[model samples]
Target chain A: MHLYRYEENPLITPNDVPPHHDGFEVIGAFNAGVAKFQGEVLLLLRVAERPMSDDPNIVKAPVWNPETGKVDVYEFRKDDPRYDFSDPRVIKEAGAERFLYLTSLSYLRLARSQDGRRFTIDDRPFVYPSNELETFGIEDPRITYIDGTYYIYFSAVSPKGVGEAMVSTTDFRTVTHHGMIFAPENKDVLIFPEKINGKYYALHRPVPRSNGRPEVWIAESENLLHWGNHRFLFGLREGKWDSARIGGGAVPIKTEHGWLELYHGASDDHRYCMGAVLLDLNDPAKVIARSERPLVEPEADYEVNGFFGRVVFSCGALVDGDVVKMYYGAADTSMACVELKLDEILDSLVKV
Target chain B: MHLYRYEENPLITPNDVPPHHDGFEVIGAFNAGVAKFQGEVLLLLRVAERPMSDDPNIVKAPVWNPETGKVDVYEFRKDDPRYDFSDPRVIKEAGAERFLYLTSLSYLRLARSQDGRRFTIDDRPFVYPSNELETFGIEDPRITYIDGTYYIYFSAVSPKGVGEAMVSTTDFRTVTHHGMIFAPENKDVLIFPEKINGKYYALHRPVPRSNGRPEVWIAESENLLHWGNHRFLFGLREGKWDSARIGGGAVPIKTEHGWLELYHGASDDHRYCMGAVLLDLNDPAKVIARSERPLVEPEADYEVNGFFGRVVFSCGALVDGDVVKMYYGAADTSMACVELKLDEILDSLVKV
Candidate 1:
């Protein structure tokens, strides 16, 4: 895989601007979405911000107060038996509700570029959650273009569950929310380029029956709102490097061979990397071929250790002529960009 | 799934004959292995014998030529490509060298009880392959146990890949040949009384890959030969039911669930089935909660239709405790058998 980075690496960082409220440290600024709009490159970034406190014994985290429709912060002792402060992502207690430091709500920020490099970021957040369900944060935004509509699908996390929601915008500024497209406890939703035959098709990660681990599923519908004919696409390759979890990444592109999709997978150790797959054009449920190698990984410092470690996540990409521009979050703390030749990536796939 | 039986239900059925060539048809009914000690219930079947004819038109219908080690059949009126004279159970021409035909041989037969229930069969083959690739025409045959070392699996085809082969014997006694396992190039070999996690395990069918159709892949591997991975575990489900092709039938016995299997599915049309998988203890692969599904299918079928069809097939089930019995034919002609157990089948699964 060819990776072309910006002359100035870490295109987006924590110091670029404070993510949320004051007195909070902003980190984990990584790529959330990347697109070419009106000749200018646009990037949606996920910035992890946490409260700045000096008390060594105090651990404050954010929690959605459904009753109040506001985020609440609670402080727990470092040695509290009920709380597991060992995990950097969340601070949870055995029987008590889980929470992030109230100062940690994430919002999407915008960054614009002219030559697909050297970006200028906006001071304010481009999007934010308005209700308690999304009070914790809004992360991983993926952009898709259909006809003349630009659809932005993102992960909305809250106490209820991790769900998928969509927003459409023609000019970035004025956007219309499409509510939640998927039910709670689901994420990694990627819609196909065009309707198959005449029905809309989408690839989603569903945790069925709650007993088995997450697996890929295909859903179809006449309209995007009502989906049916759910079928299992493929499951995680057991005993392989991606034995843990898998999710959708860049929007699927229509190709002569099939529907080319870039997806992310994690091992038991939580090392995130990107892979590809080709699906039958007429029946998106059929997998034509899949990649045996990852397109990207957490090799840089910003991608190795940060607010979290060993995470290289992408929410979007732009197809320019024969090249693809991908923007990804590295180590959960910084944003980076890479260029790949479409033909080269496809050539790397392993046909069994 | 609609099932069509020949004019004879349990067609080419099982019969009780003292182990001997005069008593049955085709033979040498067993998978390749050396665990041949202990009492084994083998099938003795009849090997179909067609007298030579002098007429060129009648002689042109596929005939197993032992001297040349290939089927000698004439393509009358080569100009009209849509000719359909060969057996539907096998033989078809897609294009050029891609001709699909039943690789007929001999077959393996089973023993039936006077009560139409329990039965005692021979332990040796009444017949064996006349050639190399299949020095053993022995095909799929299912087996169940009444006591110790009692096992059976059959499917006997001819070495010339034209007729069926059946073989059977007890304590290596007067062997009997029942006939062929099926016709030729046909297989979805299955044995029932399914087991798993300390139960029985059966084998079944699934089609092979062709013109974009799917192929059969087995799961169970207790001692390494017996299987339980459910056939048709992967394939394309288009606009029509069984649109892709499928095979293998009934189900195997394993613990609580019984193992169910079938042939592969060719797209719109094409392909063949074979192989097996394991099922749950009480539920069987039929319940589907524990088993994967369809472990095999026809990738090669001689007579999938006509007097036969896309080849490769199996039927009948005999169990010896947790051990399952399976019988099947290749290209619709030859037969063979393999023994498997519930514990062994469950251990071979690549669980999701």
Candidate 2:
């Protein structure tokens, strides 16, 4: 409830990204994962690209074909009812069996800042789909710096499903893929900076195929290749705002109290908001305290309008002693920054 | 159109299957893939089962959990508008974004037939999902016997997407899993038994993420594990019975004229029918001819009145001299058999 928004908010938008081609335009530049690397603040910006078409009846989407080893295009006639273009960010196949696809192709683009306020974006894409498993494109990257290495875990999108894939960089310039860490039916994975109890721990959100609700889960790995010991961490609180789904945010920060985790939750209406949860320092499976209400909601006009309206989702955050600097995507379109006192958030928390 | 339907149709139903437990009931015993092995005809019947509850407002689906090595059940209340129980067989999530789930769990069951009409179905299941790739269940299996080995290719469903997986059985008792042969966003696979031009080829259907259209594709594999060289085979014929989607039916028969293949097609209105296509013997990718009209359609009451009405899908067929014995699932609920002169089908197919 006590947060200060930056004066020059909406730091990055479509105008910041360089054009890929003549017919394609950058539609969105938001949902960035933040980190402090090489004495500079880095934001892994999600850049969305869509084809510019003159025909009012047609909409085009970019496609990556691994079979042909080329990038192709899809043109959909607006006159045909097969497509649901209600949300500007994504297009849904309007049929008995639904297939929701993002209208524009999204890939990770790097933006760096000296003061963590103004950023200079790179012209080339940082991460894109290079294989069939990533045909849709890579998105929502969460950077975890552990043991002198920066590990980026991102959501690999394809027609198959969304899953978490890992890539590591020692110097931010040389990136190396570590293969798909988890298969389909997984997302919103955030790894801790160091191992807990001699085992690497990560917070994940697994969508249950059964009747169980979707919630945040914690898993441990000895080698980081084979993960097991999954336990539910945070769940939906019935008859509440964050009662539908909860996901892990950036890397968890260890404090004297416990491991502090800033998470995102959504209601049944799909309105996303930011919340906080505290886990036991030794056992993250044991949730200590949780926020009773949302920390950040869609209140500003920039957060109220654009691509997908009424959504304030955070991918990463930095805790500098008392001040919690958070970078969140506004309305699923643009990015903004906010800072809140750590005591104010902990005071707002309720014992769970 | 000269095919003769057997008088004793709908040979197997849910009532014929032995109960797995007292509380549960078999919902469907249909879509059997046919094969002749060890001097007897075999039917790989898809038996679907669901848990029964005293409460009329709830529906339950059984899930095999590999983690716990137990069958977990998902119970959904009818009052929850989030669940759509429109189609009796499948329960759909009815939000703006939708996903269809089978109300009952399905697995392949073996039914032995000495006379090819009356069958003694085995009490135990033949094949079900055992890994994460097949979390949903395997469906619509096609058996191709090559070099004294029976290969079973089936549709593997999960939350990720639908794809094809392969297995082999030397004695139909000990089956060997070959892992997932194809990735997600694909199905309707038919593998040719022997190698053509020193390569094992298969007919596949890859649903394009783009707007290109859904059509049958051909791929070649050197070791049957790594497949490549994909080529488009047959596509939909607009404004006709087979105007929407077409998939491979059985293994292509080696005829004197060429390789004759019987396939299944569906119209936009979900009207499923059967058709035939001829490919060059040396080059299976080259289509020599195609059926101008449907070979078998849902015209009878048995075909139009069961689960998933107005559907007739084939999984396997056999060729003995000039006669073709074909087994198909009607309305996705019950199986039936028909016989046709092979020459008659070839004559019906016109050069395209």
lDDT of each: 0.54, 0.78
Candidate 2 lDDT score at position B122: 94
Winner by TM-score: 2
CAPRI quality band, candidate 2 = incorrect
Interface RMSD of each: 22.0, 10.1
Query: Tens-digit lDDT track for model 2 on A63-150?
Result: 7788885567887887778778765665678863334566678788899999888999997888777776577778888999888888
lDDT, candidate 1, A11-45, per-residue tens: 88888766566667886677577777898988877
Per-candidate DockQ values are 0.01, 0.05
Shift of residue B301 alpha carbon in model 2, Å: 6.4
The local lDDT score (0 to 100) that residue A123 gets in candidate 1 is 81
By lDDT, the best candidate is: 2
Q: What is the lDDT of residue A259 in candidate 2?
A: 89
lDDT of 1 by residue, B168-282 (tens): 3454434544333222223444433323465333333321111112223233323212222232233344652344555444334334433444333443654444334344444
